[model samples]
Target: MTPEEILPDDLMERIRGRAAGYDQDNSFFHEDLAELAAAGYLKVFVPVPDGGLGLGLEAAAALQRRLATAAPATALAVNMHLVWTGVAHVLAARGDDSLGFVLKEAGQGEVFAFGISEAGNDSMLFDSGTTATPEGDGSYSFTGRKIFTSLSLGWTRLGIFGKDAAARNGDGELVFGFIGRETPGHETLTDWNTLGMRASQSNTTLLQGAVVPPERIFRKLPVGPNQDPLVFAIFACFETLLAAVYTGIGERAFTLALEAAKHRTSAKYGGRSYAQDPDIRWKIAEAAMAMDGIQPQLASVARDVDALVDHGPQWFPKLVGLKVRATENARAVVDIAVRVSGGSSYFRGSELERLYRDVLAGIFHPSNEESAHSTVANAWLGPLEM
Candidate 1:
């Protein structure tokens, strides 16, 4: 189904109307979450037979882009849950049923959140600062701090991983598992104030000996990176969905700029609309041109993932490259939009102003500018010399 069918214009408008209040209060999108859950948006990746829409990555990305236009924070926070379900689908399609339960739980309305990021842990998925201790019953107890845990207020299940320092005969192993919200030894900190994307309320989570039963324990890979399907699935889904949200931000900003240009008149030109001004038109054209290039790239990458096109070694570069381009392009588009939008965008509560702040968050997500460049460089130039 089309994005419009899933999120009607009226529903989008209501969500757009509340974006400002949520940002201003620095609160979570509780009402938006409820509405989205009732709409079955939370189950977009689960198979139709399992009570979900059974959408592919391309379709899910489209829906997320559309949703971000209305409420970026809401879209971003919700992306966490979609990532897990999307990962499950991707893995299962590749003949790996280890994470099949994730899909089943999602179909039953379970909310999943990612818990991979950490403080000063630049290794990302390759390694972890968290400690994982085997409980001798096939279970593991994780003790570490996870930051930027979006959906912090609402996640029923959190996917986390840590290092089993004693495993692999002193080499080490990374244990992956899922823990419930009601699980003891975990705390969600109430510290989410930020420069932008405030409504996401992506607070820090302290996992103090949180345990995941054997049934929930999934993969246990070597210490460093390897050709693992789970690794590829997580990176693919996470990067693609994230790029979609930022692309939506740019799309909305461009629309608002166009609207502002057509309506606002310049007294210096005898009340002529800014749309007639050469410079204003040029700026709008630049924003449009930049936005035009992103949609196709985003669509192509997501579609390739869904189709299982074997990019092989180039997949990481493509995934990280798309993320960087979409994010940087969106940020640039928002800046141009603000310039063409005049002084009103400078004031608080204006959609453009909120977007200006929201778009800045693109720089902070994983596959960040530096890391993205490094990944692409490595893909083409090989690793750095000693």
Candidate 2:
């Protein structure tokens, strides 16, 4: 199905209307989540036979971009669930059914969340700060903290990873597994208050011996980077979907700027429309040009992933590049929108004001500016000559 069909204009308007309220109240998008779930939005990656939309990654990215145009925080939070399901879909399409359960559970209406982020583990997917102690029965107990756990209140299954320090004869292994919300050892702190994206409520999670049975354990890769399809799938889905959200933000900002330029009259220019002002026209054109370049990149990368295009070592660079470009461009567009929309946008309840703050969060996601640059550099220049 098309993005418009998945998220109708009326539904988007309702979501847009709730965004400011959720931000002001510093609350989760409970209503939005319920509405989206009821609309079968959370299962966009699940197969048709499993009762989902059965759309590809490109389509899923489009849907997310559409969702973000209405509510960025909600879209950001929902991205966590979609990431896991998307990863499952990616892996399954590659003949790996290891995460097939994710699809099944999601199709059954269970919410899956991405829980791999840590406080200071910059190694990202390559390494883990969390400890995964192996059990006698092949299960594992995870003990560590996972920060920025989005959908904290709504996730039924959280996909997390940690290092089993004792595995591989002390070489260590990164253990990936899923823990249910009913698990007794994890706690979600209500400390998500932030400068923006407040509705995401992405609080920190403390895992105090959260155990996953062998059945839930999916991958056990050696410490540090490797050529695992699971890694590719996670990075591909996370980065592309993330880019889609920010691209949507940029699209919305550009639209708002266009409207402002057309309607706002300039007193200094004899009450003429700002659109007639040369500077305002220039800013609008700048935003439009910036936004125009991102959709094609987002579309191409997402389509490649869905089609299983093999970029080899260049894949990481492509994924990270798309994320960095989309996010940075979106921030620039929001900034321009704020500048063109006049001082009223500075008000707390103004959507442009909120977007300005929300867009700043793009710098904090994985494959950040520094990381993206490093990845691309290494991909081109080869790893630093030690």
Candidate 3:
């Protein structure tokens, strides 16, 4: 089904109406979350037999793009849950049912949030500063802090990982697992006040000594990047879904610029609409062209993931490139939209103002600018000599 059919225009309008208020109050999108859950949006990536829409990655990305057009913060936060479900689908398709339970729980209305991000851990999933101590009973205790834990106020389960320096003959192993919100030693700090995307409530989390049973400890790979299906699934879902959100931001900004250009009249132009002004039209066109290039790239990467197209070493480059393009293009579009809309968009409450802040958050996500460039460089040029 099309994204419009899945999310519908009226739902988007309602969500859009509340976005500004949520930003103003630095609040979570509780009402929007409830509405989305009721619509089964959270289950978009779960299997059909599991009571979800069973959408492929491409279709899910489209829906996320549409969702973000109305409420980027809400869509960004929801992407966490979708990422896990998407990861589960990816694993299942590859004959690895390790995360099958995630899909099942999602179908049953359980919310899962990503908790892998850590302060100063620039290596992203490849390495961790947190400690995962293995217990004699095959369980592990995680003791470290996690930053940017989206859906922090509402998630039932949080997927996290850390390194066990003593495991695998002191070579160090990365332990992946999930723990409940009420799990002992897990603390969610009320520290989400941010410049944008405030509704996401992506607060810092402190894991003093959270335990994960054996069944929950899914993977125990070496301390760096490897040929693991888990790695592939995480990168594929995270990068693709993130790109979709930013693409939607750019799409919305482009539309707003078009509307502004058509409606606003310039007295200096003798009552002609700004749409008739050469400079305004040029800015609008430039934003449109840049924004137009993002959609197909988002769709192709997502489709490749769903189809298991083997890019091999090129996969990371492709994923990171799509994310960087979408985010940077979205920022440009928002800038053009603000310019084309005149000083009115610069007001404290204008949608463009909030979006400007929200779009900036994209740069700080995984596969950041420097890391993305390095990944592409390494993929083509190989690691630096020595």
Candidate 4:
């Protein structure tokens, strides 16, 4: 079946309904992903000949949003596969055939680790002294530890970003090769401790000069301070997906706050109802408004990103602008959740408290603040030939 037929309509609704219960019970999410693999949802972006949906970023963004709203941790788990599947799909459809097998494997229930981070200094986006250089015998050895890798349990492949440091920096080039998580020299060190995205199962990956055959490597693509259209689309999708999940988390938090407010009574004014006070009422309205405010911007950004890919890559800077807004809105969603939940929301397992911790994950990504600064500076200084 085509990607359009990959998931039944009932399954989508089922995943949505599954979200409400995931926090309370994780059975469905932990297994549903494997189920998604069985059904080929994981490889939808890959084309038919390669055994995938051949879907574009627009559809991928929607799927990302849907899974994210269902279970934040589950969404985090799938992000690894989506990224691998995406680049691999492009490679396959564009005529590189080897990567197609990995996509097929992914569709058949195999998973890859996003082993980008490292232990000493944070390096998820950039390679932190990791190197993939050639051995005299026609193979390259991957060395160095990667920290905070997600869905580390039972993974089969890894999308690692490393540089052939022997070359100059920037031109040093970053490569994300697909490697077996259990490759002989590879080691996994557990120590997942996080305040949010709890149960994400993040851990450290140590490749002790693990040797990867040249055949295991997908050709490295060019990336820079200013990325190409495909890279920008991935970044846009990442930001948009994060925004939607935070919105979902906030929605749950707001509901908790509203329910608490409705039943809460205060004796400060001699048995006055807390929910009856104008100040308290304003918080509820504000939280609802913030939640409502995010939807249009989300839809707009998704549409613009979709339109750009089909036309040309010239307009990525515009999509980045929308992504920046979504990133800021994500932070706002958390603030609204906190405001409406009030003090008592701190109780453990409180959806507000959980979501508050969850939202923090959004900002942990590359500094959008820095990205914005450079963009504005470049635009003001005016553009020219690269």
lDDT, candidate 4, 1-386, per-residue tens: 43235556666566545543554543326656666777777776666665667675556655665555445666666776676666555545445565666767776667776777665543334444678776866567788888767777747888676667555554765555667756778887666666667556667888888877767766454334434333543455555555555555555566667777777777775676668867778887887787677766666666655454353443444444545554566566556656655677777666666666766776665435556555555665765458
Better of 1 and 4 by lDDT: 1
Off by over 4 Å in 3: none
lDDT by residue (264-294, candidate 1, tens digit) is 9999778999999999999999999999999
Error of 2 at 328 (Å): 0.3
Q: State every prediction's TM-score relative to the real structure.
A: 0.99, 0.99, 0.99, 0.76
Deviation of model 3 at 121, angstroms: 0.5
lDDT of the candidates, in the order given: 0.94, 0.94, 0.93, 0.62
- Which lDDT tens digits does candidate 2 get at residues 284-370? 888888888999999999999988899989999999999999999999999999999999999978989999999999999999999
- For candidate 4, list the clashing residue pairs, or say none: 44-53, 117-147, 118-147
Error of 2 at 339 (Å): 0.8
| Clashing pairs counted in every model | 0, 0, 0, 3
